[model samples]
Target: MRAKLFILIFVCCAAALLFPSMPGTDSLKTVFRLTDEPNEVIVRGMSGSALTINISFGDEEVEQLIRELQAPYPLLLLDMEWAERYPEIVQLIKKRNIPTGLLGHAGMNYEQNLPLLNEQLEKYEDFFGTKPLWFRTSDEQFPYTLRNALWDIEVNALGSSVRWHTGEPPPVIEGEIISLPHHREQRITLTDFRKLTETRKNKSLEDVLFNMSIKTKKMPE
Candidate 1:
């Protein structure tokens, strides 16, 4: 059975703070200073959903995943350091045209400082030729300061609207980006290499994502 899902889209609000300007972001501070809050609105809606999975890359089964998850089930997130160490992975990713994003900082709340955020952005942008279209903090967090920094760089990310991997709590429509949360009774995830090597699944993960995108589009906002 496909579960019902909600997509939450919200805004980023910037406020008064003294932040150090970074080399590539001289205009960022002034960009947010002009507005006390985001001019965007949050929209909530429901959808008939698919049994799709959105997996983040971990430090395992890199080659196997590359062989399997091309095109439809594209790679999503990888820690910046992993991307640096295995630069060849990026080449594979480019060939597949997979959309990948940077995982967040090592610890909590550094997005308040422009230079600190700049460092993270510079890492991926240098390689990918653009800032990330998606991002996630240590946890699936979206603190106000983090939102401000992400908004400055035109980054859009999705976070679990409720708990990290649970599928119960309704999404709270108050954050920087649109999050479409799907419910699957927890399995060993696609990122779980040990489990993938063990179990045999009937449906391909690619079909799940494709069906999901279609179903979600049909849902009225």
Candidate 2:
């Protein structure tokens, strides 16, 4: 009797310990997150005018290769600092009526330089006849400083969000800024981009503008 009692007690203790509570399994359903949902906001172009392949010097081969790209595929995404040094390139591009975009490296802590940035924007407009379509602190990192800097700039001054290396979508802001997908190089054939632009015409600019404003509000402030 004692042996049976001992066996029962052991079994009861083991069961209690093993099944302390009903095992709850977490749902592992993965969902695709939309970074850029198709909305009323129709960004005008498809192919980025040019891929921001290189911003610094010493890549002569790359620059040459970029120049060899077909006409209308003007290599416009250039470094602001590089443009300052090679103003001739800017002039040449403008003379050709190529759509160029400038990426400025105002640094991550760029909030303090808003005034300077605004002045620079005016200078660009004066030189290029229009402000660049995009501006970001850096090409790789997206910290709070970059966000603050972007917020400080006039809504219409910049074009697209800076490409982040993290593959994370940029914090949406008011305007038709192209938020590139992560790891996706901003390079595309003129033919392909042209197709994208053609399709975009189906949407009105006002719709695109409204969507952009809505997206900006959704971003974490």
Candidate 3:
């Protein structure tokens, strides 16, 4: 009886080692969850010597727009819906050779957002002559289905280290990605922002991502 019990225990242990229980559907679904925070890989790829500033632009006032465009080599996050109505501004951005990414709206479910996102993506490609590598939603949460679709195409859903609202001054911290969203009543200026971090190096989105060795669909000309 003791010999038989030992054999049974050995077989059970071997079976458990060889064939683990499958993960439940819920566990699998968690793999597709979207986050509004930078992943470890992104944080690790950042430069320890510089701060990366991301400025969100869309239908901003002329003075504010100019200030943002002139800020220290920021990654301009433009809204596609606004871009559709303002081609001249888009052309100006192209001429200036600023590094840019897409900014989107949230709140809709997957079904409603999918078509809108597709249209925006098409417009972006048409405007920039290359596929975008990054996207950010106005709201923190992005729909899981759209996130999955973006992942399939290798587009990174970016999250910032600090999000600068209008009234407050843009803070400077090395090795951080600061997102400056638009507010019509924004009071800060380029001079004010520069005064804080003028000593540190400034880099574009592409600059940091290149450090990670990510391959895009095509390099934007």
The best candidate by lDDT is 3
lDDT of 2 by residue, 1-221 (tens): 23443454455456657766632111100111112321111123222222233343323433443455444332345555566766766665556544454455544444455466666567667776655544433343333444444444422223333332233333433333343221124443334433433432222222343232323212222
lDDT of 2: 0.39
Candidates in order, TM-scores: namely 0.50, 0.42, 0.61
Quantify all predictions' global Cα lDDT against the true fold: 0.42, 0.39, 0.53
Candidates sorted by TM-score, best first: 3, 1, 2
| Tens digit per residue, CA lDDT, model 1, 144-210 | 6566566676664334322323333233332212222111223223344323222322122223322
Task: Report the poorest 10 consecutive residues by lDDT, candidate 1.
Answer: 5-14
Candidate number that wins on TM-score, 1 or 2: 1
CA lDDT of 87 in candidate 1? 78
206 in model 3: Cα distance from truth in Å? 3.1
lDDT of residue 71 for candidate 1: 30
Per-residue lDDT, model 2, residue 38, is: 17
